[model samples]
Target chain A: MAKTPLDEIRSSQVWRSIFRHGYPDTERNRTLAALSNIFLHLHPVRVRKSGLGVRYTWCMGGLTFFLFLVETITGILLMFYYRPTGDAAYNDIAALRDHVPLGVMRELHRWGAHAMVVSVWLHMFRVFLTGSYKPPREFNWCVGVILLVLTLLLSFTGYLLPWDQLAIWAITVGSNMARATPFLGHEGPGASALSVHGLPLIHSSDDARFGLLAGPLVGEGALLRFYVLHCILIPFVASILMAVHFWRVRKDGGISGPM
Target chain B: MLSLLLAEGHGGGLIPAPVRSAIDRLCDPQYFLPLFFVAFVAGLVFYRKWTQPKVAGGIALAALAGFGLALTNHNFLEIVERPDNIPIVGMLGLVAFFTWYSLRLAAVNDERIEKGEGPIEKTGSNDRVLVWPDLVFSEFIALILCTVLLVVWAIAVKAPLEDPANPFKTPNPSKAPWYFLGLQEMLVYYDPWLAGVVLPGLIIVGLCAAPYIDFNPKGNGYYTFKERRFAISAFLFGFLNLWVVMVLIGTFLRGPNWNVFGPFEKWDVHKVVVLNNVNLSEGFWIGWLKTGFPAWFGASPANGSLAQAGNVIARELPGLVLVLLYLAVPPPVLASTVMKGFYKRMGFIRFNLLVFLMLSMMCLPIKMILRWTLNLKYLVAMPEWFLNI
Candidate 1:
């Protein structure tokens, strides 16, 4: 039996160096080293020596990450079939529901979207409850909160990608609501001034929805903008933040436990 | 409603006819050509760093070549769709191959670093711990479950593209989605600016800022009751009260046609006319003082339908109750033995204020809900009233 390329790759000195750290040198020592390493800091430092089983901190953050990964995979697949044109978008979605060979991708993306929101909220609640956001971790907590907002933004942007009546009206109402913000609101001071004076300022009420959708209301341009945002822009930002978020946990001395 | 009177006469643009298919639109080289080039460049950079760390600069040069290729290929779609071309699949294979190779190369560099003789330096902290088995196994389990769920969902339902949008025909009850129904529900009770903007903005901003605002680090991994028991209890109570108010208003306050004013509604013409005639100073002085009487009030003249049911139950009762509630409840409650007990226990003055503010803000929604459920006729009778606006 000869070793396959994958096996050889796995056994290669480079693979061993990057993945395993120094060899365990020995099995027990390897196990101890694993327990002590910062990269694997998420694991419990010590198993219970007693007859009682290991105590697991509810890993809500890990679950949220898992859901996120699932979303990314499903989202990319959905992109293959989804067309972000105003005319075809709604029809395309309906077609996927009624006719596409693997229509379940749409449902998974939808349900996963809903589930991800729920999980992210729970993760935040869990962290709050655990006092994980205290002191040195406060900055990370802020980052996590931004990540949550981005998660929500991802959902909002993706919701419009389908370009159905539901998506249109929802975004309309949502953007209209955005227009009502005190300073930046469409009918607010800047907006009123813009309408009265015909200023080309970015903050003009006329430009509010246009700024967001990259064009007038939920039209062809809006759909393309949302598609890029949902698929490419937001996901890229979130992935980078997520990597920082994970690295920060190790830097912040792992998750908080009972005092 | 006053807002109806104030609304500009202009109508919004009609929804346009559906345009071309998304695939046709997106497939244009102008849209995706740059994207492909960027991805290729990124892949090359990653691949070179991972596989041949020593010659990683070569990958950058290769990326530049791919960028040039993408730039030159204007008819990418034609090439992709051609019978013999199979460009899309080829591109996918190329990306995957590069990614895999990069991973392998990176692994080898890591191994060399481990032996303490490679050009790639290992930080001392890298020696700390390496518990991949447990982490990897758990991750694998989670990944498998997620995959199964995805498969099940994909198998169960098919989502189709819909007919191109037709903007001309506005659907009746053009409401927002279910999540936003909660806010849409609020619009019926409050002013559009308040309902559509301020409240939702405040909630989201407040939610994002929760960690900073509630800096108490005393209790973690405990129920709300267990950690900062007073704050949590107050928050829950306030949340429940607000929820109840929202539900009541959403269900009962809004009219069938979403009208703030209707034929049967009482017009608030008197107030409007008075406000229009009298300057703000005079109106404010007379309105607020209960001393400087207006000429009409002084004369006590009866003025048609306005005078006919001047003291109708719907017209006067809610305002009376609201004034009384606002004036009466808080002081008595604040003076109560229970609140005193709470104040004594929660030593922080800000906590006391927060509790009071939470309870007080809950009243706006409550008052609005009450007016909606009980005073629809009054609202209808009132012609473009200030409150409605």
Candidate 2:
């Protein structure tokens, strides 16, 4: 009524159109505020204040999500320079590190990858420690474990992109582990154990690692395949799992508080 | 347009020699970080004792001040020469935050209790804060703080880039990434099939299946280790003793050709420790009978039952018994005694699942100890293709 600055902005046409609600100061507006916003969709209209305790969650889940977002951004920028080829990939990484504008993007992405893994682990640990994964939240916890595995895969695949000695050998060590993966591996259980008329089930030609690398070993083909898995495949799967994870968190009555 | 990446500033400050040297030592990530981590863990125990949050805050502030000062005057170039500095700083920061948070949580609980209330403060949706402004503001604050920290770190320490991909020119200690260092350490005590493949699969499966199997409703939605002693102790043992210990060993103690070098030991390229790995069959024949393989069982000519006899009765007989005893003895013992309550509470299927998980989890440490003391590689190492496990 006095035509104050606060009243002026709230009454403005542009503000009204964009926000749909002014200052979420009332109950109706608070509900509307959560409902109207796109990003806020992840949240319930309210949370138990007990769940808001820093020690309860340790901010691990939030930090993991933040790191993922950082990785997404820095990764997209990296894609602008990276070429998923044996010849060009290593050189591209070197160029990105040395010559590119805001070359620290590479470093950010690298460090972000490491941070995401650690945070995801801690998040799981927090969930377990609190017994938050009990009962109705069991499915969400399983989803979280899947997401954890996906995170590891993402890191493993991304490891080869640098195409350095560290990258190559690490991938070699990691990929070799697949050979002992039960039936899917050439040397794993049930591979040689199951012989239908002297024909082994899984052979060197059709093992999990062979399928992963697209060749006998970690080479150019492996690098290209890993690039696709890292960039396109794993992230997409992780995102879907994460969506369900967050949805379940809300559906299961938000974060676990005092029982 | 090249964004000017600022040259890292790591100048010597106006601090005195002795104090600076002490600060330097206290901040020497290798020593300080581990000690700080242990201190933080101990602090967490005390923190739950309903301490004043202000004390925690004061300590955090002191740590931050000291750490910040160290960062300002510290020789980043020298420290940055090692790739581990990122984790060092990140870990220290997290520990500091954790200490403060733990004490704060204790204080909050104390306050709640003093108000003639329970641990839970449940309010209806009417008392809720708006997700848009209230929640988003805090999240954005966290995100922005993280972004700034990451940016500063990225600018300060350039990501490590080793030589180009060369399969022929392997590193002296061709290490996996830090995350997989635990597995790498396992490779020391186990066959690749076991350590790199089987154990990892089992761990993942066990973790995924944990919540479903675990039906102890005692510690749900609370942080009391007393209520969830088994869960807490098991998790802490696996985490701190197994995973963290292995990773540290892999990262620090493991040197050229994967020898056990001490923290202060220089990694000599030629330092080789000869290890004789014996398969189950070999161990049986050579270890027990003191005879060669083919002649041990008196089966030379190519026959099926003879091979089976050699396998079941000859070589694998004692080993199989030992393995069976190892797996079976623990469950009935646990069921009758210490974990009898868990066995009763978790029911048949879930109880069996839990026991299986626990036994397998116990195997890692048992195997590790055997490796350390007795130089035992695998319990039943056949090395016969898929039957290795």
Candidate 3:
């Protein structure tokens, strides 16, 4: 048989060096293909046919991860134009909408965020309904729950980026909750009891809300803090947890089914 | 609230007045919540019957058709078409459809199991397929499809950006993001400490603790509603009724001043409902008893002394005792009665933890009912310490 151009390329030194497996036409090569690639290695060489069905899993978990990737890419593009400051943040968003080319980046990020929340929730629903969270997978379920929360926090922090009435009030409403963080919050139930020498330890300037906002209210400092959390801190934590979650999924027997 | 709306005007224009008023009455939170609970309970109870594919599909079609018809109305259209609220509308459909789909699958599998057959998922051959073409390719396709869907969505609906934030000019009925709207709705019934801090905290904690607390060995890696009825029902109640229903209420129904508006009702700024909330202490020591409160109840604790704090505690003793009884009584009674099996299965510590969380979850509904019926604001109102439940 004549060696096609694809075959010739596959046989090339650099191509061979890059890809440990040939074209995954044959069964052996297919297994090698999944096992060899860094990304594909996340999955086993072969998967149970039942687990692959869209009906069983709803593909929500994978879609959630994909949405995260979409958010990350679009978010990076947005960072180029955005200035997370009280003076410039809102203007930057306006610029993205009016001035910047393919301003759809901002829209994509926002919509992708909303989609991720819905997808993660649906993913949790699927897992619970299938009893995938039972037994040996319990720890991973906890990890998944934490990831779910981190997902919300990411969306919450990002909500402040536009710095509009919608952004500010929504965040204000959310952060107001911090003001009631038990002893940590000035206005919480046990906050009044936390005092030294009859001087209140929990106050407007020093409570959990203060710590969250880095001020008495959501101001420029909070904008900066949320920027970091949305772009850096929470994502960093979520990524680490996601890694653990995926790793455990593989480790604790991939794609649970009848034993 | 419904009467107020009705008395204001005959609901003329657009859809028929009778239909509009009927919807308005139903969407009132008092009726809405109980009706939602009934629907949820009915869904779970009749899962086997209704989750027959034909019936489930018919229901989904009817629901969508009804929703589509409702969108023809100006007032309902205005609310659902808001760019931010768009996702919530999608959420309503998606959650409903998926819930039905899942229950249908469970019904099929449960029937199969009863007939001494493996679940549909397990009935298929135990054959495995290559990940390269089968799994990876499908995942890549899903990725592409999601990308296309997201891009189309983004193009179709511009992300909402209201006026530049003004600290002085708060938006009427200021709301949290769509997902946290449930928690915001909770603030109506709870003190900020509980609604804002503790309840959210407990939700996460409870979710994390579920797998551990659930000791049942049946239904693992399978769908069987009959075997895991309690667990499934409890979870659905929390997720659908408590969380999603609240989100829906907050998004579509809540209007200016955090008042309820029917789907077909206009959001008038002037619309007002009296909310002269009274505490349990006041109901006990003042209203019902027809006597003045304890001496220190109304007195300011200026000294911040132990003696002063004692006076405040003494003043709130009625509320304090009632709250203490509420918290302390339920677990033992539940363990001995309705939840005897769960108590025996979960053991002392796990059972108590389960009961504690369950009661905590139940608190929102109980408090809401109290507020609705008696205009009761707080069970224990102690503003001196910023503590109220």
Candidate 4:
């Protein structure tokens, strides 16, 4: 029998290699379809019908991850224009906001950061309320928590990048709090205490606050440090933790369902 | 007295407290954590563990606590900046609670069997849908909808930008980002180390360790508030009541000098309250220790020696007892009563760990109350080292 163009392509080696299976008409091929593709493999071959219910899992975690991807793309685009310096930081943002083409990318990134924090929080809330953070899925929950903290850190560090009145003072207020971190801060409790010598182990210059801001205040050094943290360090750590989080979700028997 | 509660900053005089000053009211569970123990006891009686499961009792207790705290002040329903945000925040919280409540009534968990291989072991019928079309299609739609939302939001509200970073000219209020405003609010009530570093660190650590520390195995892979009532309730209290409340207070109530403003009051830059933010040591030394910190312990109590420290301690003995009771008492009580099953389930090691974390978590509310009620800035105030609470 003479095959049509569709059938011909389906039978051809090119299509066979690309798809690695038939049109997924049958159940066997459907499972294979998910198993064979890297992207599809992220999802299980077959998730329970119950697990698919939005009523149960609010789809918050997935939404958060999606927002993260949006942020990554928009943030990268923003990095090209952003100069995270003391003098030019605010000016650069103004330029990006006002003059740059597709300047809405900055807005998207900004809003996305806000949305991501919100979504991540909701995701955690959803998980906790549902008791999805139980045994067999315990460590994954820890990863999720770390991811939450990382998300907040990312938002905070990115906040300073704007270097405007809000950014400058907010970071100052936020970072200044660090100087009073009990054992870690120079001004904190036990920072001055020693068994033998009266010489304090940590002083104003040698505390967590000092390390965070290279000097005593939020100046040039702090701006540069925050930029690097906002751009590079936090995102790097977050992505790694996120990767672990997703992997663990799959490893710990996919998403939870009615037991 | 009314004028003090009505003082410029952080609250509306409309929401009256059952005391002389609203802050001085012996309420606001964030400070008076001992109140939680009362609620827990009442919940235990209300639930009667034999007949009921975990759901209704916890919610009732939550409601009770809410009702109690509302007696102090609830600006949640009050208007602040605009009308939209109030309904949004209100609905957001209400919807989640109702969803859980409705799900309980539905008995959604009972219809299903345990998972083995996949959910619904040996149903024999193929209830599973194909992933490629079914899952991907839904996700794609979600992606589109979310992107539209983000775009619309971006268009509607232009992300705010102010003058360039100026160290010299601090803003009038000099606020942190809206998110950290809660911590900033805490700073008004607590020492910087407690508000800024320790508390934040504790929250993170507690959250991360929650799953591992909790030993219950009933509500795995399912949504049942009944089986895990106490755990879920504690979380709702902390997350919604404490953290969310702090965020709200930080955002709306606080004004210049971090003084609380009434909801109806205009944020006039000139608005000022004559505040006497006296530390405990200063309060103790000047107020109580009329002569000097009993110099018997060491030379010159006022000379910043250990004797001076002892004087501060002796003066603030009531605060010390309250602090001790707030932190030390919850665990043994929980283990004996309401949280007994969990205590036994977790054993000594895990139980104590959870208790430590729980107590620390409880301290946030307790400290907050103390601030409001007594203007008690620190449970353990050490002025020289900048460590309070």
What TM-score goes with each of the models?
0.56, 0.83, 0.96, 0.80
Model 1 over residues A1-259: C-alpha lDDT tens digits?
A: 9999988987999987767544556656567566656645545543211101112223457767877887898888877777887666776677667775544677777766756665575566546534557666777887898898788788888877777665776577666665554445454333433333454344533445567867556668878888898899999999999988987876776545323
**Predictions in order: lDDT:** 0.51, 0.72, 0.88, 0.70
Best by lDDT: 3
**Full ranking by TM-score:** 3, 2, 4, 1
Off by over 4 Å in 2: A1-15, A196-201, B1-81, B88-127, B276-298, B304-313
Flag the better candidate by TM-score, 1 or 3. 3
- Cα lDDT tens digits, model 3, B140-246, are 88988998998898888787778997888899989999999999999999988999989999999999999999998877777779889988998989999999999
DockQ of model 1 vs. true complex: 0.14
Clashing pairs in 2: none
The count of residue-pair clashes in candidate 4 stands at 15
- Write model 1 residue lDDT over B174-287, tens digit each, in one string: 555433455776664555456666666555554445555455665432222233544443333333234322332232222234322111122223322111222222333345
Estimate the lDDT of model 1.
0.51
lDDT of 1 at B268: 29
> Recovered native contacts in candidate 1, as a fraction?
0.31
Candidate with the greatest DockQ versus the true structure: 3
